[model samples]
Target: MVDFNSTSFHPATFQLTGFPGQEAAHHWISIPFCVVYITAIVGNCTVLCIIWAERRLHQPMYLFLCMLSVNDLGMSLSTLPTVLGIFCFDVTDVAFDACLAQMFFIHSFSFMESGILLAMSFDRFVAICNPLRYAAILTNPRIVRIGLAVVIKSTSMLLPFPFLIKWLPICKGNVLSHPYCLHSDMMRLACADTTVNNIYGLFATLVTYGLDSVFIILSYVKILRTVFNIASYEQRLMALNTCVSHICAVLLFYVPIIAVAVMHRFGKSAPRLVQILLSYACLFVPPVLNPIVYSVKTKEIRKGISRIFSRDFL
Candidate 1:
């Protein structure tokens, strides 16, 4: 609401600590972080490549899977620089504007990922409940619109973050909880009254994560009802089998998210590293696990990956 961007602005820089107290073991700490980041990027990319190479995967579910991978890739790339900077170079000082921008992108991609997952749930619901209409309902043009809408929604929800943070007088304290930036982490350091910022953050969380989780559950409920109506138990099991990867992905994303939220609300006395680890997992786990879940659960993706690896060996 305020034109904080009007003036030539260069706010004071902030220090990013890899581990607040255990600064001596930063390099050792980086080992796990490096593994997670590399795995997320490579795993999501492999999923994308496999889907693209296999014509049989040219369906609504795979398209949504592609969207999830893209969002995961964006998020990993977004936070990689800051995390590596703190762990490797010990470069902790980040400009005010840069910090705000990084936080904005990180949160935006996170919300975008949630939206993509919701779309994937709808894809599963349609395929399971009304198989005959799946193609017509999630055609290429419609899928494109849905993707665009997700991007728009994510941007709209998080676009104000930087500016809101800009208006905050953070000159008093710039140190954050983690090496990377986050809305909650950044807001806690603000010198001004952050009631509005806190409200907006909570509101955004409910709109994105809360509503999406509800719809995902409902989609599965309807799917279950439809599957159970089938005469054959084998047919029902096969129908539900298609959703195993999606179910795993939803758990991977939400479990860490809920953990972080609970820690923030009730675990104020908890160790800082615990909070940081949970937050990192909230972002890292889904990307790393999504591809693995799909590969293990979906026969097509597994065979496609096998063929690609066999060719590479030759």
Candidate 2:
């Protein structure tokens, strides 16, 4: 190991761990991981393809979904290599730069997902709360700008992470906590002062998770008020029904995130397996479930999927 105390010190490679002290079970564990990866890839790709092929689905809601699918795919592929390496091939070494890149993409995509969900919430808000203006407000040009804003905002927020990480000298062993690299985990390994990193991380978290979540809640509050004012019971149910998929998607994305955050903060005495499993849930669950939830809950998506399958195979 190079002298980490030196100003110019940097690690060439970092060791990645799958399950701590569970090497024997890595092969077994790879099964579920593989299943999740396969499902996430196929599911998200199918969503994207269906949304793309169904010209009728080129609305603000489906457009936001397309962005979500893309983000899910990015997050899944970002972790695939290190995860497969550790579990399947037993190769744990990852180049430092590669590790940083993976961390960057994973976190950026995560932020993008949050932003997309917030945008979806806004879509629902406009559709239900202000139905007449929905079309005029969420035009194709406006949707494109929102999508671009989400991408740029998420990527820009995370852009400083790599340089910030590289600046710190890591006297601690370069062994990552999980198969995939994470910004928080990387900061933990650095021996130098990480106050700036921590502060910036907190800032990013507040900007993405905190602000986006608040906006989503406010949008829903407005939606509920608008729905309640409708005269007919069936109309209210129909209005709320339209949001079921998006609501599921939001909860699926955020609940695990909240759990992981709580575990990191309060579950210091929690088992290592619990921590790792929760981390996996945060990364894997949303991507796998979002597409399935949308397909199950939205009639249009179901029809689109069936149409594609019938045309291609039957």
* Model number with the top TM-score: 2
- What local lDDT score does residue 185 receive in model 1, on the 0 to 100 scale? 76
**Model 1, span 87-204: residue lDDT tens:** 8777887877788889988999999988998999999999998899889898999999999999999999998888887777654456777788888777776667999998988899
Q: What is the C-alpha lDDT of each candidate?
A: 0.86, 0.92
Question: Residues 1-314, candidate 2, lDDT per residue (tens digit)?
Answer: 53243545767788889888889988998999899999999999999989888899999999999999999999999999999989999999988889999999999999999999999999999999778999999999999999999999999999999999998887688888989999998888888889999999999999999999999999999999999999999999999999999999999999999998899899989998888889999899998999999999999999988998899896
Q: Count the backbone clashes (under 3 Å) in each candidate.
A: 0, 0
Model 2, position 44: C-alpha lDDT score = 94
Q: What is residue 107's positional error in candidate 1, in angstroms?
A: 0.4
- Pairs with steric clashes in candidate 2: none
Identify the candidate with maximal lDDT: 2
Q: Distance (Å) between predicted and true CA of 305, model 1?
A: 1.3
TM-score of each: 0.95, 0.96
